[model samples]
Target: MRNLVILGAGTAGTMMANHLISKLPKKEWKITIVDQYETHYYQPGFLFLPFDIYTTKQVKKKGSKFIPKDVRYIQEKIELIEPEKNVVQLEKSGELAYDILIVATGTKIAPEEIDGMAGPEWYKSIFDFYTYEGAKALRNKLREWEGGKLVVHITEMPIKCPVAPLEFAFLADSYFKNKGMRDKVDITYVTPLGGAFTKPKATKALHHLLEEKGIKEVTDFNIERVDYENKKIIDYADIEIEYDLLVTVPTNIGDALIERSGMGDDLNFVPTDKATLQTKDYENIFAIGDATNLPASKAGSVAHFEAEILEENILRYIKGEPLKAEFDGHANCFIETGGGKALLIDFNYNHEPVEGTFPFPGIGPLNLLKESRMNHMGKMAFRWIYWNMLIKGISIPFVSAKMSEKGKHLEETV
Candidate 1:
C-alpha cells in the first residue's frame, strides 16, 4: 500500500478525507491527516460571536470527530515539507513519506506584522474577532464598557471573509440601537478599498445601506502604524483616525512552514494553477481553500465547490491521465446587515453579483444581491447545513459545482 498524506484537517482537508475514503481503494491507498491543533472551529460562526449570537460551544469541536475512522489522524506540528523527496518533517513525531500530498493549511491573522499592533494596548483597546480568544475578549469589553468612538477597520485586503468588517459595523449599529445607546456611540468604518465592497453592484448597494445606518465610511486609507498611546491609526499619507474602541482585521498570511519549505509565494500561499489547484512547482502537491494563491474569495463556499473538481483531478493523476482544469472560482457568501436582515451574493470568475433569485428561477426562498429577512433566515440555517451536510462530503442539492446562468440576471455592459 502507498501512503497519501494530507496536511491540516481544516474544512478543505476534512471534506477531502471523506470524499477520498469512499472513492479510493482501501487496499491500495493508506491515507493519513496531520494537524497541530485539536479543535475545529466553525469559522463563519466567528462573525456572530462578538454580537453574543453564538457561544463558544457552538463554534468548536474536536478535530478527530469529523475525521473518518478508516483514515489515520495524527496530531503534530509540521516543521518542513521536502517536496523534492516527498517527505514531511514533524516537530514532535518523526518524518513521513508520501506518494501524494494535499496541502490544505489555511491562512491566519498576524497582528504582530504591524508595528505597535501587538504592543501594550493589544488586547486592551485593540481587538480582533478573527481568533477565538480575541472574539471572547471583545464580547466582554462590549458588554460592560460605555460606547464612544467605535471604529471597525480592515488593516489590509486578501483577509479571511472580506466582508466581515462591514458586517461588524452593521451589527454594531443594531447592537447599540438595541442597547438604547445609539446616541452615545459614534460608529465609523475604515477600509483600504475604494468602496464598501470589492464588487461594483454589491458595493453600490452596501454603500446605500451604510448611508442609511449613519455609519461613516473612510476609504482608500492604507494603514502605516498603530498609535497605541494616543489611540490613533496613521495611514501612509499622514492621515490619522482616532478611536476609543478599535475592532480590526489584521494582516493575514499563510503558515510559516510554507515559507520554510520554499513552496509558497510572497504571502506564503502556494503558487497554484488557478483552475487545477495543482502547485506550479510540484505536480505531486495540490492546494485548496485559503492555501492557494487563487484569485478567489478566501471563503468556505469556494472550497466546497473546488473539492469535487480536486477529487476528480487527483484520481486522474493516480491513473497517469491528464488532469482536468474544472475549477471556475465559484464563491457565495451571506452579508449580515443587522436588524434581522441580510444579503446574499453569488458569482464566479467572469461575473459580478446582480439582482436575482437563488437555487431556483423566479422561485427562490432567498433573494440575491438584495436585503431581506428571508436572507437572514438562510444565513442562520447555513450553520445546520454546514455541520450535517457539507463536512460529510455531501453535495448541496440543486447547486452545481460550476456557476449557472439559469436564475441569475446579468448586468448590462457598456
Candidate 2:
C-alpha cells in the first residue's frame, strides 16, 4: 500500500483526511496523520472564551476522538519536512516517507515578533485573545477590572479570523453595558489598515457599526513597539496610544517546520498554487488552510470551502488529469455586532460583501451583510456544526463550495 501522510490534524488536515478516506481506493492507499498535541481546539471559540460565552472544556477535545480508526494517528512533534526527499522527520518516529504529502500546519500568533509586546506586561496589562492561554488570562483580568481605557488592536493583517479583534471591541461594549460600567470604559480600535476591514464595502458597514457602539478608531497606525512601562504602544511615526488594557492580535505566521524545510515564504507560509492547493515546488505536495499563502481570508469557512476544492484537485492529480482551477476564494463570516445580533458577509475574489439573503435566494432565514438575530443564532450554532458536521467532512446543507451570486444585491466597483 502507498503511504499518504498529512501534517497537522487541525481543522483543515482532519477534514482532508475524512474527505479522502471515502474517496481513495482503500486497499491501494494507507492514510496517516500527524500532530504534536492530543487536543484539537475550536480556535474560533477562542474569541468567545474571554467573554465567558464558551468554557475551556467547550473549546477543546481529544484529537484522536475525531480521527478515523482506519487511519494511522501519530502523536509526535514534526521536526522538519524534507520536501525534496518527500520525507518528513519526526522527533521520535524518525523519517516518514510519503507518496503524497498534505501540509495543514496552519498559522499561529507570533507575539514575540513584536518588540516589548510579549515583555514584562504580557498576560498582565498586555494580552492576546488568539490563544487559549491568552483568552483565559484576559477573562480573569476582566473579571475584577474596573473600567478604563481598553484598546483592541491588530498588530498586522493576514491574521486568523481577521474580524475577531473588532468583534472583541463590540462585545466589550455590550459586556460593559451589562456590567453597568459602560460609562467608565473607554474603548478604542487600532489597526494597521486605513479602514475597519480589508474589503471596501464591508469596511464602510463596519465603520458605521463601530461609530454606533461609540468605539474610537485609529487607522494607518503601524506599530513600532510597545512601551510596557508607560502602558502605551508607539507607532512608526512616534504616535502613541496609551491603554489600561491592551488586547492585541500579534503577527500571524505559519509553522516553523515550513521554515526548517526551506519551502516557505518570509512569514513561513508555503507558497502553493492558489487555485489547485498544490505546492508550487512539488505536485505531490498540497497545502490547505492558513499554511498556504492564499489571498483568501484566513478563516475556518475559507478552509471548509478550500477542502472541497482541494479533494477534487488531489483526486485529479492522482488520476493524471489536468487540475481544474475552480477555487474562487469563496469565504463567508458572521461578524458579531454585540447585543444578540450579527452581520453575515459572503464574498469571493471578484466580489465584496453586500446585503442579501444566504443559502436561500430571496427566502433566507439568514440575511447577508445585514444585522439580524437569526445570524447571531447561526453563529452560536456553528460550534455544534464544527464538531459534528464540519471537521467530519460532512457537507453542509444548502451551502455549496463555490459562492452563489444570485441571492446577493451586487454593486459595481468604482
Candidate 3:
C-alpha cells in the first residue's frame, strides 16, 4: 500500500483526513495522521473563554475522537521533515516514509520573538488569548479584577482569526458596561496595520464602532518590546503606550519542523502556489490552512474552503491528472460588536468586503458589514456547525467553496 502521511491533527488536518479516507481507494492507500497534541481545541472558543461565554469543557475534545477509524492516528512529536527522502522523523516513533505528504502543521505564537514578552509578567498581566492556557488565565484575570487601563494589542499580522483582537475589544466594552465599570476602565486597541482591518470598507465600519465605543485606537505601531517593569509597550518609533493589563496576540510562526526542513520562508510558513495550494518546489507535497504562506486570513473558514479544493486536487494528482480546482483566498468572518449584535464579512482575493445581503441577494437573513442581532445568533450558531459539519468533512448547506458575487454589491470606481 502506498503511504499518505499527514502532519498535524488540527482542524485542517482532521478535515483532510476525513475527506481522503472517503475518496481514496482503501486497497491502494494507507493513511496516517501525526500530531503531538492529544486534545483538539475549538480555537474560536478561545475568544469567548475570557468573556466567560464558553467554559473549558465547551472548548476542548479529544483529537483522536474526531479522526476517522479507517485512518491511523499517532500522537507524537515530529523532529524533522526530510521532504527530499519522503521521510518524517519523530522523536519517539521511527521514521515514516510517504508517497504523498500534506503539511498542515499550523502556525504558532512566538511571544519570545519580542523582548520581555515571555518575561515575569507573562500569565500575570501580559496575557494572550490564542492558547487554551492563556485564555483560561485571562478569564480568571478578568474576573474579580477591577477595571483599569486594558489594552487589546497585536504584535504582528498573519495571526489566526485576524478579527479576534477586535472582537475582544468589542466584548470587553460590553463586559465592562454590564459590570457598571465602564467609567472605571479605559480601553485601547493597538495594531501594526494602518487601519482597523486589512480591508478598507470593513476597517471604516469597525473604526467607527471603536470611536463610538470610546476605545482608543493606535494604528501603525510596530511593537518593539514589552516594558514589563513600567507596564508599557514600546513601539519601533520609540513611542510608549502604558497599560494596566495587556491582552496581546503575539507574533505567529509556522511549526519548528517546517523551519528545520528548510522548506519554509523566514516566518516558517511553507511557500505554496497561491492558486493551487501546492508547494512551489515539491510536486508531491501539498499545503493547506495556516501552514502555507498563502496571503489569505489564517482562519478556520479559509482552511475549510481550501480542504474542498485540496481534496479534489489530491485525487487528480493520484490519477496522474492536472489539478483543476484553485483556491481563491476566500474568507468569511463574524465581527462581534457590543450588546447582542455582530457583523459578517465575506470576501476573496480580489474582492474587498462589500455591503449587501449574504446567501440571498437583497433579502438576507444575515446582513454584511452591518450589525444585527441575527448575525450575532449566526455567530453563536457557528460553534455547532463547526463541530458537526466542518471538521467532519461535511459541506455546509448553501455555502460554496468559492466566494459568490451574486449577493455582494460592488462599488463602481471611476
Candidate 4:
C-alpha cells in the first residue's frame, strides 16, 4: 500500500488528514500524522485569554479528538526529514517512509531571537499572547495592573494571524474601559510596518481606529533590542519606548525539522508554489498554511482556503495529471475595534480590501471594510466554526477557495 505521511497536527495538517482520508482509497493507501503536542490550542482565542474573554479550558482540546480514527496519530517530536530518501526520522518512533508527504508543521515564535526578550522580565513585565502559557500568564498580569503605559509591540512580521496584535490592542482598550481604567492606561502600538497593516486600504481604516481609540501609533520602527534593565525597547534609530507592561509579538519561524530537512527557505518555511501550494523543488511534497513561504496572511482562513485547492491538486498528482495553479491568496479577517463593534476585510493577491457586503453582493448580513455589531458577533462565533467545521475539513457554505469580486468596490485600490 502507498503510505502518506503528514507532519504536525495543527489546523492545516489536521484538515489535510481529514480531507485525504475521505478521498484517497483506504485499501490502497495508509495515512499517518505526527506531532509532539497532545493538546490543540484554539490559537485565535489566545487574543481574548488575557482579557478574560476566553478561559483556558475554553480554548484547549485534545489533538486526537479532532483527528479521524481512520488516520494513525503518532505523538512524537520529529528529528529530521530525509526528503530525498522519502523518509522521516522521529525522536521516539523509528523511521517512517511515505509515498506522499505534507509539511504543515507551522511557525513558532522565537522570543530569544531578540536580545533580552526572554530575560529578567519574561512573564513579568515582558509577555506574549502567541502561546497558551504566555496568554495565561499575561492574564494574571493584566488583572492586577491598575493602570500604566501598556506597550503592544511587534518584533517582526510574518507572524501567525497578522491582525492578532492589533486585535489585542483593541481588546485591551475595551478591557481597560470596562474596568474603568481606560483613562489611566496609556496604550501604544509599535510596529515595523510603514502603516498599521500590510494592505493599504485596511491600514488606512485601522489607522483611524487607532487614533480614535487614543492608542499612540509608532510606525517604521525596526526593533533592535529590548533594554530589560531599563524596561525599554530601543529601535534601530535609537528611539526608546518605555512600558510598565510589554506585550510583544516576536519573530516567527517554521519547524526545526524543516531546517534539518534542507528543503526550506532561510526562515525554514518550505518553498511552495504561490498558486498551487506544491513544494517548488519536490514533486511529491506539498506545503500549506504558515509552513509555506507564501506572501499571504498566515491566518486560519488562508489554510482553510488552501486545503480545498490542495485536496484537488493531490488527487491530480496521484492520477499523474498536471496540477492547477488556483490559489488566489484569498484572505478574510475580522478586526476587533473595541466595544461591541468589529470590521471585516476580504481581498485576494491583487485586490486590496474594499467596502461592500460579504458572502452576498450589496446585501450582506456581514459588512466588509466597516465596523458593525454583527461583525463583532461573527468574530465571537468563529471559534465554534473553527472547531466544528474548519479542522474537520468541512467546506464552508458560500465560501470559495478563490476570492470573488462580487462584493467589493474595485475603484478604491490604494
lDDT: which is higher, 1 or 3?
3
User: If scored against the real structure, what TM-score would every candidate get?
Assistant: 0.98, 0.99, 0.98, 0.99
lDDT (C-alpha, whole model) for all candidates = 0.90, 0.93, 0.93, 0.93
lDDT of 2: 0.93
For model 3, residues 61-150, the per-residue Cα lDDT tens digits are 988889999999999999999988999999899899999999999999999999999999999999999999999999999997798999
Residue-pair clash count for candidate 1: 0
Instruction: Write one digit per residue (lDDT tens) for candidate 2, span 24-140.
Output: 898999999999989999999998998888999999999999898788999999999987888999999999999999999999889899899989999999999988899999999
TM-score, model 2 to reference: 0.99
lDDT of 3 at 210: 99
Candidate RMSDs in Å, in order, are: 1.2, 0.9, 1.3, 1.0
Per-residue lDDT for 1-414 in model 4, tens only? Answer: 999999999999999999999899999999999999999999999999999999999899999999999999999999999988999999988799999999999999999899989998999999999999999999999999988899999988788988999989999999999999899999999999999998898899999999999999999988999998888999989999998899999999998888888988888899999999989998999999999999989999999999999999999999999999999999988988889999998988888888988889888989998999999999999999999999999998888889988967865334
Give candidate 3's whole-model lDDT: 0.93
Off by over 4 Å in 2: 412-414
Model 4: which residue pairs collide? none
Question: Which pairs in model 1 have colliding backbones?
Answer: none
In model 2, how large is the Cα lDDT of residue 193?
Answer: 94
Lowest lDDT sum, 10 consecutive residues, model 3, at: 405-414
Q: What tens-digit string does per-residue lDDT give for candidate 1 at 1-414?
A: 998889999999999998899888999999999999999989998888888999999988888999999999999999999999999999988789999999999999999988888899987999999999899889888888698999898998898888889999999999999999999999999999999988888899999999999999999999999999999999999999999999999999999999999988888998989898898999999998899889888998888999989999999999999999889888888999999999999888878888888889899877898899999998899898888878778899988888877788876321
